[model samples]
Target: MPKSLAEVEEGRTVRIVDVVAGRGAAAMLYNLGLRPGARVEVIRSGPGPVVVRTEGGTFSIGRGLAFKVLVEEEE
Candidate 1:
């Protein structure tokens, strides 16, 4: 099942499935190396921004944007 990135726990790796946001938000996330098919490791997910590591680099995405990023946990 697909879940928002913000809900993913630390140490878990997930594949981005979709981004439910406007063009600007989507573009911003894409520029940050987050897009459908991309894989990200949850570095930190808590009260603050959710931090993730991708093939490009590590980044901190605010909870708002993180909620728009849908992903499936990787085995």
Candidate 2:
């Protein structure tokens, strides 16, 4: 099932299924290497920023922004 990146547990690797953000937000995420089909590992998920590691690099996403990223568990 698809869930928000913020909902994903730490240490879990997930594939970005969709971005439910506005154009600007989507573009920003895209620029940060977080677009649809991108595979990212949840480095941290909690009250603070959600950290994700991708092939490009690692990023700290804000709660609101992370919530807009739809992801599915990998494996």
Candidate 3:
């Protein structure tokens, strides 16, 4: 099922299905090594944004942006 990144609890992994296209969204996310099929774990969430730990590194994405990152969760 589809869910927001913020909705994903910490320490859980999820496969990235799609990223919302924007002026530089793809490139930006790509720079972080966030591509389709990539798995990411939610490190922390709350306050202003959600933090996800990826292979490339850690990135902080706001709730709005996190919502755009469609993912299929895996338990």
Worst 10 residues of 3 by lDDT: 1-10
Give the per-residue lDDT digits (tens) of candidate 3, residues 9-60. Answer: 7788998888876859878887788877789989987667888988888888
In model 1, the runs with Cα more than 4 Å from the true position are: none
Ranking by TM-score: 2, 1, 3
After the best TM-score superposition of candidate 2, give how far the Cα of residue 62 lies from its true spot, in angstroms: 0.4
**Which digits, one per residue and each the tens of the lDDT, describe model 1 over residues 1-75?**
899999999999999999999999999988877999999999999998999999999999989989999999998
The residue-level lDDT of candidate 3 at 33 comes to: 83
Strongest candidate by TM-score: 2
Q: Tens digit of lDDT per residue, candidate 2, span 23-72? A: 99899999988999999999999998999999999999999999999999
- State each model's CA lDDT, in order: 0.95, 0.95, 0.82
Clashing residue pairs in candidate 3 (N, C-alpha, C atoms within 3 angstroms):
none
Better of 2 and 3 by lDDT: 2
